[model samples]
Target chain A: MTRPGGRSARVRDAVHEAVVELLAAGEIDAAIPKIAERAGVNPTSIYRRWGSRDHLLLDAAVTRLRAKSPIPDTGSLRDDLLGWAEGVERSMRDRRGQILLRALVATMAPDEEPVEYLRARGDDLQNALDRAAARGEPVPTVDEVLDFVLAPLYLRVLFRRPVEPGTAARLVGRLLTALPADPAPRAGRGG
Target chain B: MTRPGGRSARVRDAVHEAVVELLAAGEIDAAIPKIAERAGVNPTSIYRRWGSRDHLLLDAAVTRLRAKSPIPDTGSLRDDLLGWAEGVERSMRDRRGQILLRALVATMAPDEEPVEYLRARGDDLQNALDRAAARGEPVPTVDEVLDFVLAPLYLRVLFRRPVEPGTAARLVGRLLTALPADPAPRAGRGG
Candidate 1:
């Protein structure tokens, strides 16, 4: 599909892929001129496409991350949470994901754009949990469930600890068994 | 009390207070010479005391943070968790605390000593939780409880929204109520 802008999807994809490659290779501190040269595009074209280095890098990193793995739904809330945790754990273990997370954290300096992106990503995960809860899963609030399951995985990542096997499964199981049933009929209110 | 190191505690306090003032004034990126000037000390003396710029900054920040607050203990585990969360939220709202958190996250890359200091701080919080749990609190595991309660506060600080009033309190109440009784005291291996 053609974007509103004149740039074709294919061209945008190519630029994004180039950006991902550069970031994965640990050239995050490289100059925009270097990025343009690596992407084989004129500096003006690159600027026109992404506006700023931070914007381009954030877009490319988030796009690559979304493409890495899908958050799974395995017909059970427990399984789904476990699967999602496992995916996050694996991503943290991968070098590219680590670099991307660090970059994102470094860039979040009480700014509007980064804050908006973070909130949107969090809402995306929260939406998935909402869907599960609507399907009559035993979890109460998406926020609580997410915090209970994902926080430890992130702790391990930030602290450089080995992601223990079955840790995700155990966390999911405990949360599932312990969470109180939704008190009211779940419909449109995405917790 | 007089120390063996020849420098008085008063001198150390003065230097640390100067560092905090510099950081609070958003001058952390200033040169060591400038910091020494601000502290009314020779650069060599500052170096002799703290070894390096990173060491000086970290020690000063840590001291300020530790001095500004004590870990919460509200008798009930739920109240304690909520209190701790509220304290975290307040810190995130403060300018100095925000800078400190950003500084810690920035130092997480390929820097061993700083990362070790960060981990020790987290471990200290976990130890506090352990002590709370040992006092007949109903939380199942210290690791799980700490991850669920505190990690989300950090996530909020790093990403997502600034913590809202009572968000932490509500989350703590939900989690505490949801937690199951500690598994029947495990018996030693049977004969």
Candidate 2:
């Protein structure tokens, strides 16, 4: 079993950190060789662990995206989703967020689904919904939140559509009024 | 002045057809040089026209995606959307549609929004909504259709999520009932 803070874990962390640094430094196109060098890890090991540069890039982006936007526990489904959606909108409007999203799209393949972002986002949504459920409030399934709230916002940003002022709140409001009641707290999203 | 059937237009068609052929033949990883050669055009000319292979691929995919899924005119919003959404769903479930979507994402950048697909899809939606409005039916904005109908479908497919049977109909149903009364048929989607 891989221990916490073990060599493998450390290496992974270091590589992820390097990726973030590179991205922050405006090197969105940095290659694995450059990242491995920065992380002081072997590129070969990186390939062994992550499979491809796209995978590695996406994994790091997911980490950064999640690290910033922890699911808020506002004690109400409405407030929690609004907060999270606003955070998502803000990030997507920024330079780094745009790059991360681009990397997310870049990593996607027909045969292989990118796991890092989906798993992390799913867990975050589930955690928020679970908290709302425990507080005796109704909660939408993860899939509903994904489609109704997340997809619309993210799609708008990715396509460079104009995100009107307070659009996130509008979307959140519409979602709360329209969807939900599934209560399948950890219900599966699309496959 | 670029004429409809002039050299510029002909070269573009040839290159796009070449891209579709290569993708259909399982050359998903084919490069520009190869594409240019296959199209019987110089690689430099391709770079001059499209700026990148990703752009060319996306342009071609958009053309294909639009060509197959012409928006229906059933004299009503609900039926038209259902018909069109079904076509989109059927295509996205196939191998070629998968590649086309992948190419769509690949071409997306922070600064440069891919124009071909969005323009075509927007026009298709607008045409359908216009028809609906003319028939005295309440029509959701084109943005509404894009966010509710198109984004959900495409995102699910790209993420390898199982689009449950009849989900397209469900989304279209939600779109019709959940939104509308804003007869601004050409209202812009969020940026």
Candidate 1 off by > 4 Å: A1-14, A17-26, A111-114, A138-142, A183-191, B1-28, B72-82, B111-115, B118-123, B126-142, B178-180, B183-191
DockQ each? 0.36, 0.42
Candidate 1 lDDT over B1-191, as tens digits, reads: 12446555666776777776776676757667888787787888888988877777777766665544445666666666666666666776676776776665555553242244444455555565566667865553445545666566666666644566766676566566666677333222110
- Candidate 1 chain A weakest lDDT stretch, 10 residues: A182-191
Choose the strongest candidate by TM-score: 2
Off by over 4 Å in 2: A1-14, A24-29, A40-52, A113-117, A180-191, B1-14, B24-33, B39-55, B113-117, B180-191
- Maximum-lDDT candidate: 2
lDDT of 2 by residue, B80-184 (tens): 889899988888878788778777666665566434458778877878777777877777877788878788887777666766678889888888778646665
TM-score of chain A of each: 0.76, 0.78
Q: Against the true structure, whose DockQ is highest?
A: 2
lDDT of 1 by residue, A26-124 (tens): 676776788878777788887897898888777776766555534666776666667676776677667777667667666655434335554444555
lDDT of each: 0.63, 0.78
